[model samples]
Target: MCSGFPALFFAVAYNNPRDSWSQVVPIRLRLLRERFVVFFGKGSYGRDTLINTLGVLFAAVIPVAVLPILSRLYSPAEFGLFGVFAALVGLGTIASTGRYEAAILLPEEDDAAVSIACAAFLFLTAFVSALAIIFTLAYFIGVGSVRAHSALIGLGVIAVAFSGCVQILLSAAIRKRVFAKVSFARFCAALVSAFLSILLGASTQYAEGLAIGVTAGYAVCALILSRVVARQYGGVSLPDRAAIYGQVKRYRNFPLFSLPSDFSNTLATNLPVLFFSTFFGSAATGYLTMFQRIWAGTSIMVTGLGETFRQRAATERQQTGNFNRTMRVTLLPLVLLSVVLCATLVLLGPKLFEVVAGVEWREAGVYGQILAPFVCLQFVASPVSWSFYIAERLKLLAVWQLALLVSFSLSLFVGSKLFSAQGTLAVLSCVGVVLYAIYILISERISREENKVS
Candidate 1:
């Protein structure tokens, strides 16, 4: 029954090959069973991992499905402004919760975890408020032109808060192994965002509609996730002032170090947009940004797996004092898959882009091809990089983050002077590959050291 094979399969014998189709059934059944064992085995890479990965994939697929329509409706220059806005908001979101949301799963007590979540949300509110004040002050003091798109930035502020809230809630759900709730909420959010973006693009003539739609999508997802948390985890109650302060003190390292680490990581990731806009043009930035969005499928997979891996690795390290197995299970398959995908994209990315998106985006496909190898390395290494956090190697993580920032900065400087936008992308992608390759080694070394101590 588990195999879903027909009952008649058991009645046939292997006496003759021509006797019946039963011989083929057993072979097919065996292959299916092997795959089941591989994906749903007795470890961190089991049913939960599969569910989370598939959920992330589903959520990502929705936006990708509608990208062609959105692309046609908007110009590359418009998308460039959206890219800059998104990059800034992304940078702000990294520090919104001061990385405290990441600590939600570490505490043993549910109430303590709830308190941590509260602290994160409160910190995010305060952070956004401070940013609003600073930006307002700067605007009034004869720097308004410098901060030109204040309205869109305000939307970004609200969206960052929502993003932080979603992170807190999702972290809690992951701790509780409530994969379905998180998945469903994400899927709904993506669907709503895609629909609104398409509708606004069709009905309006500006890029702000796309931005607002994106923010609304995050708002909707945050609300949906909050409801799920309330139903499943009894809602996060505000801890007593003492409990909240205590949790903050306990997790001070998260804000102190993880904050900067995550912040730098975000900046490093978005450096290309800034560089492209400055050195090339807004249209070039738009093309690069669009490619990144289309490539979000792979990034989401890495993130989904990383979240599940973080939870699993923490538990495994706590119980068995070993994390090496988690690394093996999480990285091996991803590496193999990345290799295959990179090869395919390198060969067909431009043609695929032209056929699927439009002739206008054919150049994006060429960029995608050039960037494929770097992305492949990133896909495999980024998730495993969580091992550093699980091992409580925050300082080491921060160092790597700095190294990444430097690498990207150097690549941009060198590439800009040497060649055109496409050439710069190629150079940057190569540098990305090198940095992530080093990251993989660092993560592996950390795991191995921890294993020895255990």
Candidate 2:
């Protein structure tokens, strides 16, 4: 809101009113226009939506672009190993951090932040699970059937979990209205990780390289993000005594409610690789990761749209209860676009694969094409789950996601065990269909709730 900088200096430098006025007047208006644009840019959801979409685009591209190059150098089995390990790391990481409720609740003041306190305690409980894993590995290594690098895998888990903590902290800081260092710290982490991945002796095998790259990347990210967080909020603080006991006792519903919901979400998003590894081996996981990338790439586009809808809905919902319309308004056009894109991929995927990655990844492209519809469905479905969370109706959504996962996993496991990779994916797509159905039901319920409240 500051203006007249030029006028102030000019008036001080020249004692004449006309001289100062004439010289500084245009500059003042010019400054005003620039400030207006800056304000418009920041205030508009569309501007940020575009920017976030592009960020997701580049990130999604990074793995796929690297996939071809890495596949050229390594085998399917190598990438598969990387895929499986990545999934396992992700599973452990989600369990270890366990602060998502805090990410949501810290923005609102709870009586004693007991929801947050209990969430933190649950995270420590997750670490106890990690401790169990460590001991089991130690015991197994001594018994001598598996001659693997248990410590390296353990490092990956710790690094990813720590990184998740930092990432969540960064999110909470932003929710608290801290913005200055978040972007720069995030960029620095990514840049450092990319450079470190190209190091000469960091890894020997393909899976090893991915594990090392991810761990190193996350470590760097955590360091940078932590610095930003500390600069903003004076670093993370533990819950006080009353907060510990009272929050735990009062907000115990979160564990009973949000915890399982969160875990089901975690499992639905990740369990395919974990289960696939159990039966079809690592090579199948490698193919699945490529599909994950392509599907994820499409989902990134969906994100930009969803963000726009969510912000608008947040504003609109207070005045009107037609929040479901917000999603439908944006979702329909995108779904049509998805249809064309999916068809193109289904027809041309193998050709694209052969050209970009050679024969080794041809199978991956085929998998990608088959899963395109499911990917599209999931992307739209994701924002619907938020409606439940926003309405404090997360338990139903969580139960549905868990039920879907169990059914899907059972079918996929049976198929992969009896048939092949294609069978597993096909069954997975069927599960995705069921998830889509759940999304509709949840969205409908949210709409009904809004209508009743209104």
Candidate 3:
């Protein structure tokens, strides 16, 4: 009879849906805060999250502030080339680490953790070096064209190695709770890169300048963060080959399953640029790239939020063997935020883009509106998807990525056959939103299972 009171209350509340939600949400939030304290202790997750979010906010703001000036300095052709270069870097960076850097947080022993870091760094160096050789040979043999792609090929490999190095170091910092240092590094990188791109674009009048600026920023950021990581583990001995080999073997699932999953994910996102360049032209690719940049600026915020959540989630999983509370608290707010933002974009995106980016960019704004739903889902999903790794469910993640790749391919083929670039983006967005929804459900199920086990 007493238990029935709660059900009766909810039943009555639902008679007024809007009022019910408003009442229920605050109750949920209060419960969630209490649960967070139970899982993570007081002030830990909140403080670290604030620090991380501030860093991402600074990083995101700097580039966006300069975009107007950059758009004027660089032509669409240059931006298109810049997009291609970025795509390659994205694909290669994931491959470089072989996805083993994820294990840096799993080990309780500093020695074991350091070994995993070294293994990831070694793999990254070897992978990027091999890529450099391939590109250099291609250039020398006159296949990829030294004049057209040489600058990117030369810079791309370096960026991948440096970026991979930074990732390993940052992961170490995160594991150790050095949030402030990590955040500051992010801000500095964005600030330096934006100005460098502006100065270089104005002077050199080419896409290579943008590429160079980005790579240099990563290198500088990596250098600074490496110092923080080094000081944190100042006395720890470097991992020997045997230690690294064992670490690699121990975390083989990461490379075997996580690597393929990550590679597919990266390829799926970046393939549009290559395909568009082949089918539509550089101008179309340029427009798509501009939309992507705007989306990226927004994503950085979510990414920041996710990174902090991941650090906490990893700890929670290690201690509690489940992430049910974390999932419940995190997913609801983000989903709500995404829905609201996407709706707003769908309404005002075109005019906002035309006004801020210039009249020539109005079409890009229209594309932005078409793509908002997908971006919203991505913004929410990308960060939380790390839970799959935290939960050691890389096999499921791999399967999902394969399905995503297939869906994207079909969308591209159908869109190309049926309509134009606009139609293609529209089709992709619809398909993407559906897939992301499924992914969230799968992740939620995993969380529930963990809760049951706990």
Candidate 4:
């Protein structure tokens, strides 16, 4: 019965609430009569709770469940070294041949998606090799140090990046409403990664175990993901490079200039650990990293909200060439979730941290309480920028880049000088709010113009 609500919703939603209740009764009867077989059979699996829980499961496992156990198994110094390596790996990844994989599902069909995904895998693989050669040389030549040996770290990064390609396909599968297959791939990865982490921890200490588990797990995950993708999509062809490039060029407005802003955002958000290691000890950085993860957990809300909005906005735009409803839906949740998340993180993060993270990170509780609110604000503010992506306003996105530059620079300098470790959180939060406010005004103005045009 509840499974039919989403499809039946339009009958009621398209009219005034007072009048729509009468229509809903008839619509409900009609839906059950005609669509009962579909709804009860497959649609039951696509219920809201099932969809949401799947998302939350991945969000929880990726950062918290897996990483925490790995963290405890390893030393802070080793972890910090790994963090630095991850920072570098993550940096180049954003531009891995221009995120060719993500170009899929943009109004583009599965074939376009396939090309982008395949091209992205090949591109990122080559990109990884180049980076490995460059970094490995630097490590040996006294230029830089990548912990856990460059070969292992390089392998893990490549595997993880490839897994990213698989995850994208899984996400595309979910978007296409294939819940059972998505569930299979997700749990398989989760179980394998979790077990691998424990086994690896039994022998290798610190970053080494974490790195191996990640690399080996990626190998398994990628294989499972490919099988599931093949089952769902059936058959593939060599991607049309020209056609793929055409698609990329068509959406050139999407992430091109905004790409740097995205990268900077990641850096500004996580670079604190680098600063932490430099200023404080490795242990101090580790204490704070757990809080960073908790804050990331709070961001799951933002991700969900954005996902819902993107779908709504796309539907609206196709039908009406504007996004008024999207703005309302997206912004309302952004504000409401921001408040709830910020308050909850501020209030409950301490107790929650202690229970979840154990005694080694008792200090992380205070860190979570202080940092979590800041992160909540940042996460809430973040999705507002997506409107620019949807509206083809990368120039406006670039404007925020300048704002981000100023904010990040000021935060880094001022926060480092004053609050030391604590100040980074405050500074980064402030910077995020400033940028979000700019995005809000710009988004509102664009919507107003769109309305005027209509």
Tens digits of per-residue lDDT, candidate 2, 1-454, equal 4346855655645776556667566667777888767744664545555655565556555655555565566567776776776776666665564544454444356333333534564665577467657657766768452346565466565666666666455565455443434545555555555455445223455466666766776777667766665565443465666656565555556556666666667776777877777788778887777667556655666665666666766656666865767657765776677677778778998777777777878888888777766776676576555565555565566677778778767877787778777877887877787778667666755754663321
Model 1 CA RMSD to the hidden true structure, in angstroms: 5.9
Model 1, residue 383: what's the lDDT?
80
What lDDT score goes with residue 262 in model 1?
A: 81
- Residue 38's lDDT within candidate 4 is 58
- Measured with C-alpha atoms, the lDDT of residue 209 in candidate 2 is 61
RMSD (Å) per prediction: 5.9, 7.4, 7.6, 6.3
- The numbered model that scores best in TM-score is 3
Which pairs clash in model 4? Answer: 74-206
lDDT of 1 by residue, 393-421 (tens): 77777888899999899999899999999
- The best-first sequence of candidates by TM-score reads 3, 1, 2, 4
Put down candidate 3 lDDT per residue, 353-434, tens digits, no spaces. Answer: 7777777777778888999999898878877887777776766788889999999988988887788999999999999999
Give the alpha-carbon lDDT of every model.
Answer: 0.83, 0.63, 0.83, 0.64
Off by over 4 Å in 3: 1-43, 144-147, 304-332, 383-392, 450-454
Instruction: State the local distance difference test value for candidate 3.
Output: 0.83
lDDT of 3 at 220: 84
| Clash total of candidate 2 | 1
